[model samples]
Target: MKEIAKISGIAYLMIFISGFYANFAVLESLLDINNPSITTANFINNHSQFGNGLLGFVMMLFFDALLVWSLFGLTKSISKNITYLASFFRLLHALFFGIALFKLWNIYQLTFNASNSVTLQHRVMKLLLDFDTLWTVGLLFFGIHLIVLGYLALKSQYIPKALGLLLLLAAIGYIIDGMAKLFMPNYIDYKDVFEVIVIMPSVIGEFSFTVWLLIKGFKKQRGLQNAKFV
Candidate 1:
């Protein structure tokens, strides 16, 4: 089990890095800074036709898939106490990914068709809004899963408790941010601290945890390897 956990964690971590980098680097680079919305709209209008953005879209699709895969591996590594919850969360994650994939398809249509018709743009915009709604819900589920999984890790002797604690804190921040975004649009601008407090720590903690898991695997402390789900 310990060995499995280590290997799985490493895989998850690698995919996480790949997905995030593709978005932040390739996708973001393609966007125009000055007129982000218009530029993105145009990009969608243009490349989406002959699948110009196909590569990027596929890459983004893989991100969610990787996330789901990682979560599954993480859940398997942990105790069985929360196995059901973990599975549930993974399902939610996959659902969100599906939603995102559909949205991307719509975006492809909007971009390639280039009708420049207000009605079409409005329809695409509505689809985009629906995608955002699903994404936000998925985030909430993801956050909850992390918090619970982190708690499990903290209690276990296999992984470091500090890493688990950091995950928990990060989950809190995500939940808060999601709630604010959903309920209070006006408060969106004030979430700088929230983003910093949650995102940076999470990236660091998860990165460290991933590295450690890959390199050191898990310890045999407290007979964790053979223990049944508590």
Candidate 2:
């Protein structure tokens, strides 16, 4: 169980890193008004954009699988039936990921035909806008799932309470940010500010939790082993 937890943790951490670069450095630059100069865009397009996006998608797939595994592991670690609820939320989480993955695929398709044609550009821009809308809705669902899962983790003795707390905070931030984008799309781009302040901290917290899990596994593993010995 410990070994499995460690492996899952490492997988999730990789997912976090790859997803961050893809979203922040690639997609955000494409959409945000605060993007760098054309030279920077050229450098990214020439050097690492496709690779990063592909890698991020692969990592996210692995992360989804690992999250399923972790849900089961948490069930065993805590010896509780509430993990059924956790598992349900995990499924919702995977669904959210699927939506994002589909959007990524559309973006990749658009990349292939990127040219100075007005029609193609307009179509691509519409796809991007739709992608943004889907992502916002996905985040709302994902955030609710996280809050429920985080509460379950907090109640369990195997995982650290800090991780659960961070997850809860992340859920709250995501909910607020998603809603703001949905309802007040013209409210001074609070989404950008939320990403820097609230979202980044949540990412850091999850990163820390992943590192801890990868390094140490769950706290109850050794106790369970000792109990077996006795």
What TM-score would every model get versus the actual structure? 0.77, 0.79
**Residues 1-230 of candidate 1: C-alpha lDDT, one tens digit per residue:** 46555656656565566556644554445445344366456655456332534454455455545545555555554566475676577568657856765775776666674654666656666665676677777778878877877877776666678878877876787688778767886765675776686578667767766776777655544655543456
lDDT of each: 0.63, 0.65
What lDDT is reached at residue 20 by model 2?
75
The residue ranges of model 2 lying beyond 4 angstroms of the native Cα positions read 32-48, 76-81, 219-230
Residue pairs in steric clash, candidate 2? Answer: none
In the range 1-230, model 2's lDDT, one tens digit per residue, is 76777776877777777777777776665553433233233333543575576567667767766777775664444534555666666677666666766765665665563543556445555665676777777778777767776776576656678888888888888888888888885845565686665577568666767787788656455555332110
Runs with alpha carbons beyond 4 Å of true place in candidate 1: 26-37, 45-78, 113-115, 219-222, 225-229
Q: Candidate 2's C-alpha lDDT?
A: 0.65
Worst 10 residues of 1 by lDDT: 48-57
